[model samples]
Target chain A: MEKRTEPALSPLLLAMRGIVKTFGRSTAVDGIDLDVPERAFLTLLGPSGCGKTTVLRMIAGFETPDAGDMRLDNTPLADVPPERRPVNTVFQSYALFPHLTVNDNVAFSLKLRGGVVDIAARVRRALDAVHMADFGDRYPHQLSGGQQQRVAVARSIIAEPRLLLLDEPLSALDRKMRGHLQIELKALQRRLGIAFVYVTHDQEEAFALSDIVVVMNKGRIAQKADPQTIYSRPADSFVADFIGNSTLVEGRIRERHGDRATIATALGDVTAPAADGLAAGDAAMLVIRPELLSTRGEGVATFTGSVGNSVFQGERSMIEAEVAGVSLRFAAEAPLAAGTPVALWLDADRSFITRIAA
Target chain B: MTFRQRHLALPVAAAIVAGCLAPLAVLVAFSFYEVEDFELVPAFSFRAWGELAFSSTDWFLIGKAVLSGVATTVFTAILGYPVALALTRLAASGKGLAVIVLLTPLYTGEIVRIYAWRIVLGGEGLVNTLLQGVGLIDEPLKFLLFSPFTIALVLTYNNLPFMVLAIWVSAEMVDRRLIEAARDLGARPIDAFFRVIFPLTTPGLAAGSLTVFALSAGEMLTPSLLGGTSGSTAMALVDNLFGTAFDWPLASALALALLATLFLVASAMAGLLLRLKGARAVVGRV
Candidate 1:
């Protein structure tokens, strides 16, 4: 692989070095280094128990790291309590005060400051930002999940914190609402120019909203890069499997040629763009994305196989072909009949050969 | 007909009304009965009500009961909040143990607990001994026992568990995220408690207050047994009128007056508490 140049560095807003957190005997976050640039939308994406939320909590000062240093805006965050931190969170459950009206909830921080010149007007502006100005008189319980989420956003932003943290803010909503709010959140982040550290297990949500995506597994960062790099060239098998519907074929490197490597798999040897440092005889994985395989090609077929199962998804079909004791899943316009012989063409150039996950 | 969960409450409700209202009805009838030659007569009369209405002592005692109950409620509420909020931070197993420890004093009979308080608060008792040993005082505190302070102290101590338990349950029901959210929104720990934790748990505060008030207000034994001179209560007078004085009509009338006063006070307290925005948010939906 090419020696990738780091994206032009922006002034750092928050930086964490070797941050670690543990609960009892189990480690939740282990020695992770992270940086959030000013006005950057960074997302910690992982499965449950992957410590993504733990990282977010440490940033918000809710949970103190067991070890390591955290600095926000060049000041140490070790002794700064959550209340004193210039950071706010939009919790997954939208932890709005049930007793307070929408306007009061949004006006909370300003009121705590004792005297903000025009709290009501600022509250109006905050609620207006989330398009919830009319909900001022209503309590949290009176609002729907989506509306409550918008209020939570307004409540967090009214304080005008240097950074905003969102922990699965849209996970409770239905798909349509999730998509709608996803766009609104992205736009809001852009407009506010506040650094946002969002945590979610949903890969699509991460991709949709984040400028930098950090994929975590087992308390450690698996990959940190742009969405396109994370999607197209996953660091290892774990990132490849976690990010998309990519079929990983375990294999051994047959030869290494610069950025490309020939991986000897059960089906046969195939060369593809490979992760750096995979020498000959190293165990590797071939990442074959569903869209990279097709039934029609200009040249010869790569593998002849019989259809094992075909599932018809809306607007498309997922066909699994059994070839050489391996299942190759690919999406097609129409379902292929089971037991039918199918000739598949592998697009090797777009595929990735990467290291096996620990 | 199908039985719903609410249907189960009907029998209990009916039993409570019958058990409570029946005796009250008897008291009302007795208050109207005229006494003749040390024997109860069934003739209706307004003599007892007229006497009670004119008695300054009866009204003063009734007002004292209200003050005692309100004082105990306030003290318990102030003391209970810290304990209740602390209990919420305990682990699940620890919470169970804590609740058991909290209610252990109640397991002892009320009379037994009252006697125990005497041993602790008496001039030569545990508290005075400790204070003397620590050189905080040169002499055993005279006001430690058989005073208004003793009655108030014992009442607050005796009723604290109920208040703590009520508030603890409410504090536990308060989502932990709300407190965190408050802090995240720039609220200090104290701010979080006042704005989020306290408001949200007002329902519990209301419950605890009513319970502590009812339990402490009608109590005659604590004041009479521990309160020396200040121990005189309306309940004690009603008992005196019923037993030694042999004035059944007067006793019943005083008892009814005290009951009415307490009920009105309790209703007002419940109304004031439940009207708070926090309590309404919690209870209005349900």
Candidate 2:
């Protein structure tokens, strides 16, 4: 409701309502609604087969929604074919025209429409946007993977589409290359000031680029929020586990005190802030972010456990604590050896009590 | 290529070269030898070549062969592209069944197919009878089986499988995402086909065209058996000279001339198709 008062600030660019897509007998995208404000870097993030790519494809007009209404710039897009729609896509495989040169590939949309002023100049500008001006004479096969991807971006943006959809564009690149392109892509999106709907399963990529991240599971949106909220205050247990290393303890709510709930778990009575619509006697899951857990903290829900295993992950160590036959994984500053007595304290006030995803 | 790779291809390469070159050598030898009293005399002479150079009928037959090959190729390509593309969209099992249905006519020998065509296209054939029964025609269509139409129609029908199979394989290799990319980049379905799908499948088109051209150009029985009045071909003349006329020298000369003419035309067809940017991309030339 707050989004209605400030319509002038960031006008709606695209809105998809109650979208659903089914393939064969399996549902790829269940009923979901999404909105993108102008220039917003929104990403539909999920694991493989979770319908993130299908959603992107639907927006691009490659796949029609079985039931939904999509609007672009407040215009109904039900009858608009992909070619006529003011949207373009950067395909996962690049899909560069192998027969055409870089210049031709970038100028394709402009040339197809014809009568466009300064076609060559616009092509050059597009190529320059991706730092591929010097490679206009080369074909797709002559370029490296990252170079091909850059050309694909240049080609997709040459016509200056109102919205650009990227389907795992950096997925085919090497790890180091993916990181480099990720930063470049974020910068490009900012410069273009065009709304971008990106899809990826990589949590870090989503966090690094998206202004708003939509987490999905089994063809349904688990949570949609800014990256920080998605990380620090996940909406559910699945979102917590998917986005970061978070320990989820399943239990029944013993009592509710205004905005807080006391959950009775195997570990004992735990107190955390309750989610909306959650009440006493309801099945709840407590989300404890690994970063908030500490071995030494002042006055918190402390538990006694033995160190199980620790993995040194470059800058920090990921330690697992065994408490009452349940393994709770958390991060530690240093590597803790196995079979050592460990005193772990949970920051219960900083944690959340939310419903478990069905 | 590595030594092992080259070694692997060497045997087939030698076999192909030997298989093709040996026939050409025999034709050349026969062209230079004189036939006296039904006996081939080992006398090298330019008499047969000189006669062939001045014969308008021989040149006409050769020109007709070129025209036949080119026309059949054009017809099959225009007609086969849609069938090949449609075949690509079928399910796996459906495609297997479709291919069998596509090549079923081949299982029936050429003689059987020729007779079947006669039954379908003859003066009082099924088509004519149906047209008359429907009151669409006052009389039977006489030109249906014994004219240039019959020759062209029969040639196209006989060679369509080759065209469709070649182009279908090529069309299948074209990435479906490329079509989507084209559409996403502001191309209609037709525009996508012309710009993306057509260009990438040129190799298949070339292969099909070449195969159909060669097969239809060298065909003799279809024209003679069904063409009625316009059924004469260079191959028929070559057969007559070698068998009944006992004129191996002139026959060999005519055969060589026809072969050379068709080869030039085939090369021209290949050159035109492969020169497109789409073909070069597939073959990795550019």
Off by over 4 Å in 2: A1-6, A299-301
Docking class of 1: medium
Give the fraction of true interface contacts kept by model 2: 0.94
Q: Please give, for residues A1-358, the per-residue lDDT of candidate 1 as tens digits.
A: 3342445567788989999999999999999999999899999999999999999999999899999999888789999999899999999999999999999999999999986899999999999999999999998888999999999999999889999999999999999999999999999999999999999999999999999999999999999999999999999999999988888999999999999999999989999999988999999999999899999997889988999999999899999999999899899999989999999999999999999999
Q: What overall lDDT goes with each candidate model?
A: 0.94, 0.92
Error of 1 at B217 (Å): 0.7
Scored against the true structure, residue A206 in model 1 reaches a CA lDDT of 96
| Model 2 / residue A11 / CA error / Å | 1.8
Using lDDT as the measure, the top candidate is: 1
Give the Å shift of residue A6 in candidate 1: 12
| Top candidate, metric DockQ | 2
lDDT of 1 by residue, B155-174 (tens): 99999999999999999999
Model 1 interface DockQ: 0.76
